[model samples]
Target: MTEAIVIAAQAGRALAEAARRAGLRPYVADLFGDADTLALAEAYRPLSGRFGSGPAAEATLAAVDGLAAAAGSPVGVVLGSGFEDVPGLVARIAERHRLIGAAAGTVAALKDPHGFAALCGRLGIPHPSVATDAPTDPGRWLLKRVGGSGGNHIRPAPRGTAPQGYYYQARVPGRPHALNFLADGLRIEVLAVTEQWCAPTPMLPYRYAGAVVGGASEASSLPAATWTVISDFIERIVAATGLRGLGSADFLVDGSDWWLTEINPRPGATLDILDRRTTPLLAAHVAACLGCMPALGAQPADAAAAQICYADREHAPVPDLPWPDHVRDRPRPGSVVRRDAPLCTVLAEGADRQAALARLETRTARLLAVLAAKKTHPEEAP
Candidate 1:
């Protein structure tokens, strides 16, 4: 059983599921303990409360090594969403094991957003106007963090506000798009092209004003041009950044101009969501990491869109998540449910985004109400 390691329990379980479907053994590792967690590979999403210390990094390294020894497999590390600062740590892990994603040197290429915009311009890719200072007209200048994911540290720049070591880009008005690409360290296999919708408001990290991913129209259903632009952009990104394995890119479509957005160098929250609908995600990631490229298959005409679910009213524990049998990513019993932690999500496929959004929303509210009531009364165990 070759082990595939993932970070954090939720993400680990997702990748593990994908790997298992593709005939590979999955292993999960994290600072947090889980009996349900797999045992073959040492991968986990960091529990920020548990083992988050610098200078004493040796202990963490030793722990990873111990797990690798026990599994009898060289670890293939998949960097989690929040582990952006630890490319060196990733490199160190790969030194003794198998590395699946981009190397530390390539990741360091994106130390600043302004430099990234310059790189895109050099490559003939459309990019937004960038400056260190906020433009006088605040209509579109967007403040972006250089090495952040999930829209963290992102805000709309106001006039006269000076941002430090960040990028202020001209916000182009258009539909948001995402491309989940799987590269075999050489060739391209665009797993899926998702038409994205976002909330029409300023975003706060982890808060759902509307949706980071409002809705999606799968690539197979849309115009072939959508996929063409997306494939070209992925090639440009790989050539510029030297990235491999699981990576997703975001772009803004403003009329005819498709402005480039930052690329997420790891599997996204939507990765498994798309995988649940299409080709095997985790298996493909592990295969690509080992230098294999899968076929480019079209998705269903109406694969359900991945909508972000957040709490507006006082959020309470979902007592027993009456999750539809189809939903994955089961939250632990003691996990906190707030704006920061997503309550739950759903998959809806139909003619349009409105129908899918509504169905997921109804299911989320009902299931969460049951969980929230238990948070208030723990004595009333399910």
Candidate 2:
């Protein structure tokens, strides 16, 4: 069987499962060896690292080599979250295996605050102003790491000089939206536009909460002029960067106006919600990287949403409760989960975005309630 390597922080399960759907045996390496991931993967290696920080490069490459050695000649490596900040490491991996997504240089250029800002300026895109130094009025700016993913890397700018590897961005007021698309270096096919919400903590106020895929209603909500501008922005950026495979362009939208914020050069959190194609998106991603843009299947009729269920308190050892079919990224039983850490993903579908999000809230509440009861009465736990 044809094989492919998948790597990410938590959602490698989604990629591994997609690879299987694409008729490819997947060799997976990620921080979490969740039960589902282990089952879906042909061979799994647990990488050691924090969530935002890409897995330690040496260990990751070693794991990749080990997986490649065990499997037949793999097609290529499909990366997900956690690699954006470490382009040198990405280049190292590309040396050994074909990378089935954006090149390391593309990631480096897009992740570089200054470079990306300059590109936006040249392209005449409405992007937030970026600077290495902190703004005089810190409250009007946000501090962000050079290559941060997830909302954990963002915070309100502080006084004085910006720290090394961090920069200040002029804060823009709007709701967060991500345009997930597929590209073949020159052109792109827009997949879905997801509305994103945040799960805020004291320290991580911008922590990613969830996203809802609104089909036609979402399209009608935005003005045609706004979409034209967005499409132009994507075209210009792709033309300049040669971005390939599955990627998402993030934007802040208020009324009819929108500002491009960031571009994720790989499949992102929305894969769970947007991977509704008959031909698996991973397959299309590989094809796109190989310069073939496959036709995307119809969008789902019903709205869908995916939310991260974060631990409210530390679970010394997570109880072995039966996880529902709607839940994903299930942590191993008896594993310790720190407070504020992601427990699992809760998914829901409904007739529309509001309904889908409402169902997500209910499912999240029910799951949390079960865990709370188990914590209070250990013997009552299943």
| lDDT top scorer | 2
Measured with C-alpha atoms, the lDDT of residue 259 in candidate 1 is: 72
Q: Show the lowest summed lDDT stretch of 10 residues, model 1.
A: 206-215
User: Per-residue lDDT of 337-358 in model 2, one digit per residue for the tens?
Assistant: 9999999999998888889989
- In order, the Cα lDDT scores of the candidates are 0.58, 0.86
User: Alpha-carbon error at 181 in model 2, in Å?
Assistant: 0.3
Which stretches of candidate 2 lie above 4 Å from their native place?
A: 6-10, 50-55, 216-219
* Candidate number with greatest TM-score: 2
- Which segments of model 1 are wrong by more than 4 Å? 2-11, 30-46, 49-63, 134-139, 158-165, 199-222, 276-279, 296-302, 312-322, 349-355, 372-382
- Residues 1-382 of candidate 1: C-alpha lDDT, one tens digit per residue: 5544534322355555566665565545554332234332344433333223474345556655665555565446555554454556656767876666777766666445666777887887787777876487876676765565556467767677555546677777676677778876555677666665443334563222222222244224335786687688678778777777788777777655677776776777675456653557766776676767765355545445555454443444434533565455555445555654444444555555556566666766665665566556766853
* Each model's total of backbone clashes: 13, 0
**lDDT minimum window of 10 residues, candidate 2:** 1-10
RMSD of each candidate? 4.3, 1.9
